[model samples]
Target: MSQFLRSSSIHEILAFFGDLEKTRLQSISRMFYDKIIPSSLQQCFLSLLTKDKFFSYSKEQGDILYYYDIPTRTWIDVKAANHQEHYIYYSMSAVVTDLNRVLLIGGSFDPEFEQYTDAVYDWNQITNRIQPLSNVPFVSFDNGFFYYRGYVYIIEGHVDLFNQSTVRKTARFNVLGNYWQTLPSLNHANGKFNMCAFKNGFIYAFCEQMSSFYRLNSNLLGFERSTNWDLQYIQWERILIKPSVYFGFKMAVFGLNDNQILLFGGDDEFNNQITHSPISKEFSDANALKILDLTDLSLHKIVDDANQDLKIELPDMFYFNQLSEYNGKIYALGKDHIHIINLSKKEIEIIKDDGDYNEEDY
Candidate 1:
């Protein structure tokens, strides 16, 4: 039936709804496209606020992922952690996979010393908890992590706190089987590296200290049809981008467009790699934005019109983390300011989270 059978009598419950709501419900749910009944008073109406403009803020609470609604401009809770013992560290790494799952691999709670980051967490959107999963075979802090084709690949760093050893180690966790397996290690050890999955079924990886772009094949078989993947033929081809040794600063890497990757705010100042203490906020300066062109394997620093050369207006107090992209805009989130960078137009709109970060401060 295209139209609702409306009755003017008070017994008709749906008459309470105006003509528009009735038509809307009819188009949304088939229940509204029915004849009016007198005794039936129970029905379900699905109603919710729009979330497209909401920005996800990964707050201090590791378990809970907060969303800042742009329209309301309020910090709202998206989800919270259910597990207690599992450490949701400020040092942790996470990825939102294709399975509609948000997963965190490892992190440490203590700032001075690393504590309990080997376990995996699956954030339940409904429960608002980080459900702990199987542990990796080893522990790490300065690792590179990314999700692709139903698996989480980890580039291991810092074998243990006591060992203090940095070596090329790689592994993968199968979400379907809930298991972890070691893969072939890289040619060199890396710290604070960026590993992002591309649409072309390859990973673009580089450590903060290297100028080479590593294109890696997970070598997993049957990944399209199964949760488990094969790692017998894993390989990495290092493509040298620049020979000047412009090290990668510690920052979050996000996908800009189909052909380029956006490397947002980072700093050259290195923190204690061993301790992983004194987070980026402690740094006195932030770095310029970089875009990695996939087609030519070239990294270009974005230059602002205000600056004469290749430098943008550096917000000294700004430190970007949890880089998130939405509607063709890359949001560089910090404690005090959110720098919304538009790549195509080369524009930046800085929204102060708490204190105002005026260009006069820089």
Candidate 2:
């Protein structure tokens, strides 16, 4: 209220206000919401104008929760109405939670990973429901959540399925106290990885038929009243590079700052072939866009002509699973559409599919 706009009795009531008295001062500022403003400063200014756009999950539908719109590039179904059934999207692990909700994690329903799932689904886009909070003391699958700074890092995945083994179990969720701490494991455990997060909270993991590139140290996520884990040194830095490509499953590496990194698509060996395909010019130097440089940790290749894999044209190369970027566009996703990309004038668009996606049966 800034003392009712610096009172001279509101400067003699804004000389009779205006715009219909600014719509009656916004209905008298909603009757001074909780008396002179204080609903946690309207949730701390709507979480500082939060802009995650959308990322809902939970096999969406079976337990309702869709969210993926970013300006009519649809996926709708914020049909909350409170739903939940162990948010199973197999081998579950989705994260967009810091209170902007949508958190499903750790899943498995018999692909013989031995009936896993330490359930923990959230959703709640204003009660378009899917709740069931704590229960993942352990259970893995292609894991990787890492929500940095506000803490939520799950990390470790690939838990034994005929030896895709890996278990230094990591899990440190605390989304404003929905508690689930314990994150200091993984000295190089294996199985489908990819955890990028950088600049000041470093994390650059790597898995899937491993080739070494671990790092994970940024005071190892400190929090004992502001960092001081015995003078900090939380480990994991196997960056002893060796092999070459194919990593962190269903591929698409991220982090474009703190010394670049951008990889894409998987399978330089996972079903044995089919990793680079802007339109299947096949392998095109392993998906023409691999950067990974952490200042000499080398792994370059940037094929000019704006990534000419036949001058880019991907409606669906399975959309390349995931490859974030935001605000400067890079998306990629799949199972329906979204190829956005822009990587600076090397354009690409393809966001179609308004038939309200529930697809994927091929």
Candidate 3:
């Protein structure tokens, strides 16, 4: 047995054990492996092993990548090996693949150059390397981006820098094939909207500028690689429900269930009046929470059983750029904090980054 354990390949050893035994042996192997490996390498390996973690990349913070450990309740910085190869990326979109890699999509690398990028990068969590993938067909920023199944979708966004004009274009990139395909365009042209995918294989997009809620049934699209699918036949159904005008560009929207979605926190316009300054009193509604019911097409604010309004405010540094979900909670990634939404409890817990660079209970 000892000779077999020492001589066999990792695949052979893994295949020989049952599921429960494999897990037990993995835990034991990690315990012994940690003693010999460097702390940096151990962090990278542990990140891949742990499933319940949130990876956050903020262009505002330059090339540093951070991840929140749900079990330990800490945010640790995972330094990139080739962070200096690219400049700071702003208004970019990121999605974690099934292979445990983070893919960063289109965004502007430098404001001075006014250059928007079509470049996509594949960031490996284990090797801590950021490598360039195929470039997107078009350059845009602040687009509605999300990952579903094995593909990443990029929705309408600003096409140019000076004019601030948006396009109705939408596209999807095959993660495994490393290729892009243009999908059907949206009915409206808008940027900075909230987008999410449901378990029923429908992609939902909500744009406050157009006051439009649209969804596409991906299952009917037949996007397999072998098929010569004509995208023009595909259509996005514009939902009839008119969302509140206050649900502005920065609001975070996430799926609650098959027939429900939860939206909160954004630049709120009070009385149909827009506030110009970022520091204006009515600039943001950080505590507003609403649930959209698709069954009856009703939009209503969520309240507790006592008929009391639930007041949960996002942290001051919270950015609604991208969100991740694990278990039953939705993790809203921010510049220095992560706001966790507990669906069952209707509560929000903040994981704040102290000056020491560690996330703690707030």
By summed lDDT, the worst window of 10 consecutive residues in model 1 runs over 42-51
Residue pairs that clash (backbone atoms under 3 angstroms), model 1: 80-128, 82-129, 208-248, 221-230
lDDT of 1 by residue, 83-140 (tens): 3534435435655543235676665454445555577777765577667788777775
> Candidate 3 lDDT, tens digit per residue, 1-362?
85434423332333233335534644667668555433453343334434566666645455677666676767678777776544666555567654345887765465566565677788777687777788787765456777665678877654343454434677788876688887766765443444554546677776544345778877766666643455566678876644333455445677666888876655442224332213222334444577878887677777766776554464332333456566777777654556777767877787765322222311
How many residue pairs clash per model?
4, 7, 0
Model 1 quality (TM-score): 0.65
- lDDT measured at residue 172 in model 1 versus the true structure, 0 to 100: 73
The RMSD of every model to the true structure, in order and in angstroms, is 11.3, 22.0, 8.1
> For residues 1-362, what per-residue lDDT tens digits would candidate 2 score against the true structure?
76744433433333233324434444565667447444533452343233334454535345555656554456765556754344335545455532244576655354334455666677655655666678777775556665654556666655454554444566666655567776666755444554444443566665544456676665646564332333246766676544455432355566766788776554343433222212222433344556678778887655557455322243233211345556777665654556666766766677664433344521
TM-score of structure candidate 3: 0.71
TM-score, one value per model = 0.65, 0.29, 0.71
Stretches off by above 4 angstroms in model 2 are 1-64, 67-78, 82-121, 124-128, 131-151, 154-177, 180-202, 205-215, 218-228, 235-261, 264-288, 293-296, 302-331, 334-337, 340-362
Q: Give me the candidate number with maximum lDDT.
A: 3
Judge candidate 2 against the unseen true structure and give its global Cα lDDT, from 0 to 1. 0.52
Error in Å for residue 348 of model 2: 8.8
